[model samples]
Target: MESPTEKRPARRKDAEENRARIVAAARAVYASAGFDAPFDAIARHAGVGRATLYRNFPDRYALGAAIVEDDLCELEALAHEHGDRPDAFMKLLSAIVERHTETHALVPALLRGPGEHALQALVPRVTRLLTVPLQRARAAGLVRDDLTLADVIDVLAMLSAVLADDGSGRARDRRMARALELLIHGLVPRAPVGSPIGPNSPRM
Candidate 1:
């Protein structure tokens, strides 16, 4: 007979696997059909029963938050990986813009008026993920001395709005690229290295 201990490990493994499948299916369904996509579709996509989907994610908002959390965690890892580079902040920002547009359509579904509080709940975690590379860039004198993390966050919010725009495909992509370039450029220091107005200067 199978011992209880052996049976418990198998059950735990199945539960974890089901949870991962549910999250992955949610990402695909949410990306293609918006957050209002039917949970039944997600369950079918994951090859799981409706019970498993609900077991993993009790509500649509919960599933949406899980997707955002995964994206944020990926962004945080990228920030940490590139944090020591002189252009770390811009690099991080560029990567974020790319990822943001890929999932832009779902933003309204996850963060619109009725769901605003869910977005509010995520702010601190997102901010913490962003601040590290930004501070590193500041310390390296790669950004203007006056730049703050709040400024970075505000710029990102504007970028997300741009991503959510419904213009023609090529035009929208071009505008997003242009907007990101301008944002990065605005953060660059005006003074050349070793100049009187450089980061070391009191006036900086």
Candidate 2:
């Protein structure tokens, strides 16, 4: 037999482990079946009893929140890793596209109806992570000066919408690349078109 304090610590550790297991199982199930995954199925997969699952996450919303938090952490990591690259705009754009594609269900859920304040709050961190490279691209005349951080957010949202419409990941990626290329070219200042010059040398 253990002392009371020792027993409490051990019980707490076990509860923590159980909670982590449940969260992991929920993540796998949710990724495969989206938010439609059954709680019983998650409990079964986690190898925990339904009571244990509920003890860890009382409802589907709690599970969804945990998954969203995990996804955001991953995004933050990616942002920090590639936020300073020479082609940071492209990197950030690609990251955003991949994230939106991977978390298709979650994105739509967060965007639907009200209670998007949490998601909205994350935009500034995203903007700061992206704006640095975007500004650099603008300074190099590689991107449009008229574009704002909000434009980047709009483009990301559009990309998510496109992915939702066309579930073909490969096709969507190719289209996104082409679209970025066009945007980049359009940003270049155009030279005035002089009078059409014929193949012949300048007429005397």
Candidate 3:
């Protein structure tokens, strides 16, 4: 009748470090090889044994959840960091786009898989975190009058459509940069040209 936590011993520092490494490696592997990548592959990438990986994560869904949890914590920090700023919304959106470009929209895709209810729970938390920055953007006229939280969520959904890297790193980066720039211009009152984004831009 004992729970898993009750049965488990205190985690050693090295065990904790290995778990962190596995999760980080899982994220990287998923970005490059898709989420369904083999556990052995993940273990190899982490430089840990398959047994070590399994000890930490029971399955891919668990790994997905861990990645989502990490992302949520990061997002919460970003929202707090941009407190009361008018362009907080834009900055947050840009940061998200950059992350998606790197991770290939894993967070969005994670919502519909196994343990989805727990992942779906993220929606409200994400919404609540974004509410204040969105209000600031609206109040300061940094974004358009019609911009709504729903629109913001929709934008994330759109960005999440990208679930895997196509191995065309340069082309993929250009395409995503174009998409982010377009999304920003659509949300903002004015769109700038030659400000450094999209294809032909040296810096991302």
Model 2 Cα lDDT, one tens digit per residue, 26-74: 7778767777688999999889999998988877766766666666677
For model 1, residues 1-204, the per-residue Cα lDDT tens digits are 999987999999999899888888887787678777889999999999998888888888777777777777888888778756767677777877886776676667766634567678878977786676677777888888889888887888888877765563567778898988877778887766667854666431
Better of 2 and 3 by lDDT: 3
CA lDDT scores, all candidates in order: 0.78, 0.69, 0.77
* Per-model TM-score on C-alpha atoms: 0.80, 0.66, 0.78
Candidate 3 yields a Cα-based lDDT of 0.77
Candidate RMSDs in Å, in order, are 5.0, 7.0, 6.4
Candidate 3 lDDT over residue span 54-81, tens digit each: 8888888888888777777887898888
* Residue pairs in clash, model 2: none
TM-score of 2: 0.66
Highest TM-score model number: 1
For every model shown, the clashing-pair count is: 0, 0, 0
**TM-score of predicted model 1?**
0.80
Where does model 3 exceed 4 Å of error?
1-12, 105-112, 161-167, 190-204
User: What global local distance difference test value does model 1 have?
Assistant: 0.78
Identify the runs in model 1 with alpha carbons over 4 angstroms from their true place.
Answer: 113-115, 167-174, 191-204
